[model samples]
Target: ACLSRLELSALKFISGLNSGLISGLNLGEEKIMSEKIRFSVVCVCLILSFAVMPSGAAYAKRELRGKIYMVGEKDEDIPSKNTTIRIEESDDSDVSTDTAAFRLFIKDHYKTDETVTLKVEKPGYQIWQPVAGKVRIPANLENYHEKVRLDKLGSHRFMSNQAFAMLIENAARESTKTVSKSDEKPDLSRYLKEWAVKYGFGIDDVKTEMDKWAADIEKRQDNLYELGLAAFYRKNFKEADEKFIDMANLPVDWAQTQYNLADTYFAMEDWAKAAECYKNVLKVYPNYKKAIERLKLIREKR
Candidate 1:
């Protein structure tokens, strides 16, 4: 009985050992699965960061900037004695956002070659379209003054001595000080003529050149109509009619001025008159469609 009991105990011990081994293997597999899941999550986060962040950083580093200004009658005629002009880079037309206006007015005048697009707006004046202009900054102007302009929302690409000199020269030319507040119609046509003269072209010369272009357009249209008309008179009714119809609105007195008259008669189905007219159109247009069509139709009718 003792020996049987010992055997039973030994069998139980072996069974327990086998169960523990199986449990340990299952635990190792679970740990490996968890590690793989953690690694995959880390890889996804790294890819997303590289995809979105660098482009934004590059844009921040290299964004473009510029300045703005308003033109008036006189240099001193600045719109407001106390009001500073605002400069900004914007696709918007609103000038109320003139946070950069002050930067435009430092040292009694300043200039910028970095083409400024300025939107001029005031309490009573109409909101104007943004104008493309350059600004000049002054040499004596301190960074502090520039900051004041920046406070008004004036933006800048770079500050320089040349810009300041330009501002001074510009201010001396025409300031809003000389302009009056009234409904005045400036002679824009006269101004354009004057500008043409300034650019070394006389007004009459410009007009003459324009007339030449107009004549050329007319001549081309006439040539096309004639080509079509010639085909028509040759009994090429289809081509002739197409040419005549194509020139429906072109202004040209025919070479003989009688060919189209004949064509008109033929198109109206007046066979006798169409034949005569077609003959006449051919005299002038030589290739008028109506004459050919009328001659054929008349023969058929007869």
Candidate 2:
């Protein structure tokens, strides 16, 4: 114990030095240190140590952060604020969403293999569901970041829990190489059949919804980029704007999409819209030179 406060105080007393510590001990060389003095010294040492050390809330064993954005109609990641972020059932272990960001402290002894669930709650926005928003803390990494996209209220995924369960079952079957448990065979169609009765949907309608979601999940951003470039080169400003806006809506490449859309608007001399798009681009990539240049041009035009 590197020169504990009690010992230090005793040394200070014997050496004819002054100290602020008050332990009720006899300071002279012939005087003995009684049990009461020792007890008082321990209490004083504890108090001093606690006073010098930072409070528990000032630090953490591990920190995790993530971004939250709403999937707007244009597919732009509009920074969200005043949203609630929770780590499982823990309300105080983490902080809420602000500036499209939320932070958490991994204070417990959670294994790397174990995953922590994150749930987001915001007015007019759908709550994040457990099946889709699993946060796996990466092993051997200090910083962990997660990106979550929120849908507007009444647009929550899955009409019912059974539909979500079916999706999970289908995914599990497709990805796993091992045979499923022989003891239990799940009937995925039962969920769809229920949906048919409740929503008056036929097989065709269900298949159509499945196909649409599949296409969206696998959409190629590069194709949209190429098409947007082609339209711009052909002087089809409207078509270029449409293509870029579509790409932006997909939430894949915000900087490129916003820049291209802004550029197309500049070509069409839509100064205000171009300025807006350029500003949007700058929000995420603040130092983007091209966007800065276009904004400068828009300012000059005004």
Candidate 3:
């Protein structure tokens, strides 16, 4: 008789956890011992498989298959042409797509209880990796399936410097507001000094609200970076440049920020400055293909 999905799952789970138990069991005992005792031993083993084996263990033993989708602002599907998908530990090879969707089949690449990392990359789209780039196939089954989505990269990539500056400015403004209770107050310095003596924006209060705000921005620079990119997408180059510069000044080694700055300079027709910025990016990341191409273009223009 053909095994059902549930039976297959249960058998896979039992085999993974108690392979020794199955191997040790004696089917010959049915003839040697009483039929009742042989039946009881079989019942015990079956119970142990279900009781001790973890839920979803059967699923992990199976092959994994999935489809990729690109999503837009309204969660609408977009064409995913030229997208690349890669799986760790399976192979270093990548699969590319020419349409809005791509099918993935990973067979015999993973074992029960093992995790696999799936990475998807495409130009002009934010990369997607589930659960910090890893997913564990359940050990109980023979097959698994999933659907993945990728979001487009907008102005958020361009506006990091502007975002950080705004965050800092906002922090200072909020601090000032706390000091001056009134909405219409021009003399913020006087109020800050007075409030600092009592509530402490001063050096002594290590756990002050201002200090918390400062630390918060420092910890969440990525969020600020995204905001800056949003500004850049909005054609606010001045703000975007300011945010990118601020981010770079944070001593974060982000080649993309430098590259974006170069792109901004190029947009403004400052060929010399753009060329310098692109060269800086290549200096840090010698294999940055886009920067290499842009640098060549700038030099040709010069």
Cα TM-score per model: 0.23, 0.38, 0.28
True-structure lDDT of candidate 3: 0.53
By lDDT, the better pick of 2 and 3 is 2
lDDT tens readout by residue for model 2, 1-302: 67666557754554442222334535652244444455666666677677778887666466677777777777677777767777774553444446778777765677675667666766666533333455566664355566777766444353433243334334334423343675443343544455444334574566466545434423643345444534443335477568667766765386678888998999999999999898777545533446867888899998
**Using lDDT as the measure, which candidate wins?**
2
All models, RMSD in angstroms: 27.9, 13.8, 21.4
Clashes of 2: 0
Report the lDDT tens digits of candidate 3 across residue range 245-281.
Answer: 6655654356667788999999998998898788667
Better of 1 and 3 by lDDT: 3
- lDDT of all predictions: 0.40, 0.58, 0.53
**Per-residue alpha-carbon lDDT of model 1 for 65-184, expressed as tens digits?**
223233343422222333324445443332222433333322222242234334344432321212123323323333322111111112121112222222222332333234366543
Off by over 4 Å in 3: 1-63, 79-82, 92-109, 140-143, 154-302
Cα miss at 208, model 1 (Å)?
28
